[model samples]
Target: MKTLYTLGLALVLTPLPGLVQAQASAEPEIASYSIDTTLKISTDRKTRGVSDTHGEPGLELTVEAAHESGLIAQLQLGSVSRVNYPEGNNLNAMLALGWRGGNPEGWHYGLGAAREWFPGARVDEAPAGFDASFTPTGWVNTRFHTSYLVAELGWSYLTARYLYVVSRDFRGANTATVCGNYLLVKLPSGDLGPALDCYGSAMQHSRGTQLLDLDLSYPLNGQTKLVAHLGWQRVRNFRGLDTMDYRLGLEHQRWGLVWGAELAGASVRNRDLFIAIDTDGTMRQMEKPKLILTVAKKF
Candidate 1:
């Protein structure tokens, strides 16, 4: 893969011992990582069989920072359902090579990929190959990397009636074949304000469309700082159980922390992927898309 080749080349191109010694003599190498803790406070959380007391709160923690090698490892701990691990309470990690010198340094653009697991990060499923003796077998992986071309983008704003949000979810299941959209939006952050699609509180992916979140945030300091949350959320259509997608975060001095709780919402007992044609000539869907609780630390 191109990504693999590029990473290999970057690592190999590092200057040799003598060259490194010269740079080190000029400036000692200094590296550091950060860990942020977040807490969640929720409202009534219930739908089908899953339910958190109306006032039940949740939590999660995420630690992600830059590396000297243009490589970054980001880890998130919370509750969400995955294909391989359906049980609640899981953690996830995504390590990638970042493009730090670009027009925007704070904007992380790089290579590499990620995997998911429960209680722990989801595992990287083995590429479809074979069993002992070359026999072929494996479950049809339905999330994350097993899913390529699965790019996502979303936007949300608080309004009087509801927390408005719209999103498009794409996945490249078979390298050659890509699956389409899953859209959703809840009314007023449902319960948890805004978490993320393919990222946080994923149990919210019941339908895959235009949905909203229950968002609440407040300033911890005057400027460039705050603590917020996208509580628990509803999956719009069938109204499955919602998770208390809560988080506590702070942003200041161009750096901060984001972490908290993530509970899983139950899947729709009865449902289907709703589809449509967008005004942009591309295929679109009236699906129930997922939401995200975002906290950025700038440097």
Candidate 2:
């Protein structure tokens, strides 16, 4: 009787191998993460409907990582135009950190901040013997580095984003001498065309510049979509430099590659404010309407 009792006790205390394995498999798994990369080549790199590539071709690479918990981080680097960022390294670098949540089929919201760095880029210094006292602090020699905060809201197929500049300048737009000055462009008719005041103030920093963007993407088919965008760039204290920009584009995905073509242009209060002068003294209107083409691959 005692031997029988001992055998029964052993059988009750030890779990079967199959049961143990089943219990282990039933436990929930930790959330997983993924990293993605994209490389792109485009006829022109435009920011807010203004050309950053001076109507030239550009290359860009981006890396992004996402977690199941709705956090994302991204880094992008691209080649820029010397005419657009005179005296600067022809490089455009941006780092963005943000969190996004909600169902893609429903509503979504996001908040982020980004910094744009243009290494060694600066505007021409104040004219010789110009009154230095009229300029704001660090205005004459500061590089073209800008930081901004962004907020986003969207539903299916439509989204709106607002970006507020927190930096001293908006891509070096608020230089001291350029304020209240006329941007003069010589016309082919041997005359100066329409001129407008810069409307910026020497004593003011461009810390409050803001951009509002509205975008729409409507699927035309399983692999192609119609994209449209409208945006306004408001330069605080320099309203004359404000612009309204628009884009109409189509994007298609096939064979693991994405192709895009867009018509982009901006209506500025004055075109001269968007004109870029190269080191060679040639000027290119950066906001003119143009067709931009792009191809990108993801990994």
Candidate 3:
């Protein structure tokens, strides 16, 4: 009887070691991150001077390099047009590279930059928050990120206008100044453009504005999380402009499947100079702030 009992105990303990080894081999021991989609919208109000206002949809397709590694990147496509800039729209692209490490490797940190190009605008001088430059738009961006903090800096440049290749507006306005427009660029002669300047333009033709973005994230469980971000931007132009932007998100996850909802906002207005690009025809503006939802899966 004693010999039989000893044999049974040996068999059970031997199987336990094999089970532990299999479990360790089944888990990933490298670095990686996930790719997500971002949808954002914004709106304006009555403080600066506007009779009417509206909103629109903007979409962004984002990517991640590795899961265990903190390195990442992103791409985006958006449309914005209203009064004097209607037929006008924009395409913006950006990238980010960073590191992830620390206690439990939950904290991520790194730095990188981005460049954006904007074309097809009805107006020129009066600059919006996200639009690149007028007639051949581009900017150089710098970014810093950590577990709970983010910082960014940008410097923009103007490329030669390739449109029509006949207009002189492109010829007069092709310099890289943080304040004031290129040259022929002019703002809408109404409350819309003026009010925007007061609230957010930093004056007009703002070149390299300063931006600081802060974020905090909380994990509810292994597959669910929440995040909130607050941002501030300042630009130098004919006058100084300031902006406040906020975003909150809730996300659910289940291995390769993810979905989320977000609310974002911005307060912007202006009162400054004007630069018109395709005038005498039709002009429009593209700006909005609406709720957004999205879902995605990985293979």
Candidate 4:
């Protein structure tokens, strides 16, 4: 994990020493860069019906660079803490490069490639009587060494994205594809407030999953906003594996700094794997209904 972080940081910080020089003198250079850091504190750290952080807080950092020619690159690094794996913090990193074009206000399209890495994740053996030996450990690792290609098209307030699994196998699947659609609308600042966003995704694979989300945001004042989210996820080919999640948050932003507090919860179903807690305060699965605090800065 340390090595991966070092390498990613190096790539992010290194300058394109000769590329710009090779370009034609008539062309102008338009470069932009930004750094964002976030601190997240949560009651439970679960994703996709699986607990990865065992109800703990996490931190993340992202850096992005882009050029007017539509080329962009991004690097992100984060820490994962699990109650069962207290010996070390699981580290994850993602590196992506892409190109985007078209008008932001009218129509736009983008194509990108991304590589996600998990260095400290391991496959755990199932407990006695379980048919499957390879179960995902609650260690913040999907154990997925994957590379994917993404394509997106957007017009006005609607956008669609498709992701193709370019790697031979991601996790345990040999091939997988996912498509997502989003709708966003700006509303008047009345009782219900200002914005509405809806998103849905369908994944194709042996154990496919479908996800849907609705988010609404209301402006409380000039610098504060109230946000609410409702989400549903269902796993195909498996009955009784549906889950519902919701979140309510209040955020304030000023001078490129943002802070928020949220209450979130999820319902567990029979198909979800149950994590057990031992007498020594060690937790195997995550618990639901989390309180979260977030602080972020963009530069």
Top candidate (TM-score):
2
Evaluated with lDDT, which candidate comes out highest? 2
RMSD of each: 17.1, 8.8, 14.4, 15.7
Residue-level lDDT of model 4, residues 1-299, one tens digit each, is 01111111111233375643232223233344444444444444445334555566766777777666788788887665533333334776789899989986678888898877766554343111111242322221124456767777776534555555556434222111111000011111232121111111222232334455555567789899888766675545323335677778898997777888887766756422334333453434453666777777765
Error of 4 at 210 (Å): 6.0
The candidate with the higher TM-score, 2 or 3, is 2
Global lDDT of each candidate: 0.31, 0.76, 0.38, 0.52
**Candidate 3 displacement at residue 6 in angstroms:** 46
Ranking by lDDT: 2, 4, 3, 1
Runs of candidate 3 exceeding 4 Å displacement: 1-54, 66-90, 97-108, 119-204, 238-241, 254-257, 269-289
Write the residue-wise lDDT of candidate 2 on 26-87 in tens digits: 23345666788999999998887889988899899999987777888889999888666767
Which ranges of candidate 4 are over 4 A from the true structure? Answer: 1-51, 83-88, 105-107, 124-142, 153-222, 225-248, 267-271, 274-287
Candidate 4: global Cα-lDDT? 0.52
Give the number of colliding residue pairs in candidate 1.
58
Minimal lDDT window, size 10, model 1: 1-10
Q: Which regions of candidate 2 are displaced past 4 Å? A: 1-26, 127-139, 177-201
Q: What TM-score would each prediction reach against the true structure? A: 0.31, 0.81, 0.46, 0.55
What's model 3's overall lDDT? 0.38
